[model samples]
Target: MDPVPLLQALIRCPSVTPADAGALSVLEAALQPLGFACTRLRFGPEGEEVENLFARRGTGSPHLCFAGHTDVVPPGDLASWTADPFAAEIRDGLVMGRGATDMKGGIAAWIAAIASLPRDLPGSLSLLITGDEEGPSVDGTVKVLSWMAENGQIPDVCVVGEPTSRAVLGDTIKIGRRGSLNAAITLHGVQGHAAYPQRADNPVHRLVRVLHRLTAQPLDSGSEWFEPSTLQVTSVDVGNPATNVIPGTARAKLNIRFNDLHSSTSLIALLRAALDAEEARYELDTVCSGESFLTSPGPFVDALVAATRAEAGVTPKLDTGGGTSDARFITRYCPVAELGAVGATMHKADESTPVEELRALARLYAGVIRRLTAG
Candidate 1:
């Protein structure tokens, strides 16, 4: 039940993006022997099936669920990697793979830690693993949680094993994440020769003005467990190569990382108000990736901090500064927090985690279980 080998095995799977590639089966093989009942649930649009796993042991209240995913994003520009992205090579003291540090390692660590615990231990244990985390997420945790609710299996408190640690292992645990929204704007204007300054309505100028208004003001100073919300313009392009002609249309893309100060609906209204103030002809589309959520530093958070201090010997900081994750949907069902290993190499070339750190993370998960299930 050593986590290093388990982590290496998970990294070896080419379960890139939406593909399962036997990663789910590999986890099932390990969990079955641990005396846990495992169930596979697939949800999505008719033809596209997203893989999900929900396994539980014992029928007890205060059920503690460990939620995570087995999927890894595609490895871009493979030549940049010292080892094959799916090869799971071990060098120096780490294993290099796409999901090595981002996730799969953390999932393996928890399973190994659970394997060390007695099967007849107090309370209940369950795992909710999804393979659609790196994709559109339409058929992943959201659907699985709904299914669990219908079947009467929602746990009291859940721990998401996303790569939440920073700087040092167990140095921080995430209690929330800033909400994310993507917006695309298209401004319309009359096209004319560059020399005819008054003949053409400069849409670029209007677009610039609106952008200035949006960025001119601060979203917020930040929240207690979260950072100040900020909006960033990701792209602006007219795709015009001509230097003498005025482009008829201007387009720009922006992203917002917001705190509890606002919701997606309210922010969209804010954007529209800014554009309307300029009275410009424009079309805007907004997509909400996630909404902000916080569990606060109450009993649940206090227990986690206490466990970290006792086990890791350092007072773990509670943070809510990261981008969105599956935890957004989980918040609707029950209280949830994210705790895992150091994330120094997540989603990067030659991504990896130390072998010793992997085992230590397992021990940490064990401690969390002990504290949460103590009743």
Candidate 2:
């Protein structure tokens, strides 16, 4: 169960976002021979089908679930890649492809680690994998988690194999992540020729003022275990091609990465207040991807830190800085943390991981599994 071949197999699948592309089947073949009972879960509407897999070995207490996504983000501008994005090319001692680090490689490492464990050891072990982490994420881990809850498949603790290390493998363990909220605002006004400035109500002016109010102040001073929240204006568009006409509508999009101090509902209320003060007719839509969560330092985190120090020789730092991950969804069900390879290249052209690093990560994961399940 060398991770190299398994990672190569996974990377070869062009399972970008919602597409399965046989990625789960490849994982199933590998896990089945190792005594895992695998279940394929297909979720979402028919047109946007997403495939997920849940597999388990043993059926006792202290179930340790490994969660991740098999899908990779789209390989942008393939012509710029040194090799085929799905080739899993081994060059300069690195495995190169779309998902080499963003996650498929991490999944391979964990599976290989499981294969290394003694057959009779452990209370329970399971994998909750999905194909929608890189997309809208509506039909992936969230749905599988609901199914697990209904069927009593929830584990005692969970580890998400997202790329959390910033510089080297095991250097960081994400104890939590900030929540993400996306907002779109459209301001309605009257369109008029530039010569008739007094007749045209300028929605752009109003929209800019609203955006300024949102960004003018910090969301919060840094939280105890998390960084300060942030909001960025992603886009502001009038879509007016005519230089002489004032646009009738102005639209702006915003993305906020917030700490536990604020929930999406609270933030939405704050935004509404701002819009109300402007006295402008407008429409607003907000979508919350996840709420902020933290698994406070305790025995589970202690086990992971100890294992990482022993196996990778890094005193792993507990961090909460990063974009939202599936762990956000899992946090609702169980204490969860994130650990994996360095993510410096994830989602970029020529995304890759060194063979040596991949093997090392397998050993680290093995140590984590061994420590957490030890009697």
Candidate 3:
């Protein structure tokens, strides 16, 4: 039940996205002894399959599920680390590894917490672990949830073990996340000499006008439990090298991290309206990573808050900020919240978490399990 060794074992696997590297096997071995019925789910296309697991230990009400990803982002610039990125070394009380905080540590902590509990809890306890969260995400939790729904395995409430805490462990529990949208706009125009008086139209000028219109106004002042929407122009491209010639086409890319006050659909309409106002020939393409969702305060969320306060001795703020996680997919089924160790080191070189913090997270999760199922 010591999360340190479990975390070290996981960090040793090099289970980067789309590759299990026996990490799931290690987890299965641990869960099987706990009487968990583990199912290995392989999804996605051939040759690029994703590994997922859904393990449950009972069939009763108030089914509580823990969701997390075993995958870790690739270690960049390994020379910067004091040790091997996959070493999972416990140096000076820190579990140093690529995913020590980004997640594998959270997964280890949850499994350890479950081990510390009784063999016969009142309600079902389950885990939805996916390996595609760091990759394309086309074959991860979203697919697993679909299978769970078809098989009648969806949990009543779910806790995502993402590193949501900021300054200290359990200080922040993510109640929701803002939606993300990426748009690529291409404006076409007739090419001609820059010296020409009125021979050609300038697409760059038109694109700038469109962009100004989009960025001129704030999406909203900020909604309850969320922040104001933001639109940022990420890239503007005009490949013309000659200053003497006007470009034939201009391209710009923008990203919006919007709150619950707007959705991808509404924002896209707003963009199109601005483009249409220019009366120019253009093409717009967009991809929405996730729509904003909030798990309103209720019994399930209140239980998480109380457990965090009791176990970590910190009153966690119910936040709806930050980028998206797989919790976005789980929100469709049941109320979901995120809590784990402080994320100060996640996705950074020499990522790590204090060993004690990892253990404390286990205790916090244990408290969450108890409070959630106590009813």
lDDT by residue for model 3 (267-291), tens: 9999999899988899999999999
Stretches of candidate 2 exceeding 4 Å from the true structure: none
What residue runs in model 1 are displaced by over 4 Å at the alpha carbon? Answer: none
Q: What TM-score would each prediction reach against the true structure?
A: 0.96, 0.96, 0.99
Candidate 1 residue-pair clash tally? 0
By the lDDT metric, which is better: model 2 or model 3? 2
Q: What does candidate 2's lDDT look like per residue over 1-375, in tens digits?
A: 799999999999999888999999999999999999999998888877799999999999789999999999999997899899999999999999999998998999999999988987769999999999999889999999999999999999999999999898899999999999999999898899889989999888889899999999998998899999999999999999999999999999999999989999999998999899889899999999899999999999999999999999999999999888999999999999999999999999999999999999999999999998884
Q: What TM value does model 1 have?
A: 0.96
Best-performing candidate as measured by TM-score: 3
Local accuracy of candidate 1 as per-residue lDDT tens digits, 218-276: 98898777789999999999888999888899999999999999999999999998889
Q: Per-residue error at 186 for model 1, in Å? A: 1.1
Worst 10 residues of 1 by lDDT: 305-314
lDDT of 2: 0.94
Winning model by lDDT: 2
C-alpha lDDT (0 to 100) for residue 30 of candidate 3: 90
How badly does each model clash, as a count of residue pairs? 0, 0, 0
lDDT for each candidate structure: 0.89, 0.94, 0.93
Worst 10 residues of 3 by lDDT: 116-125
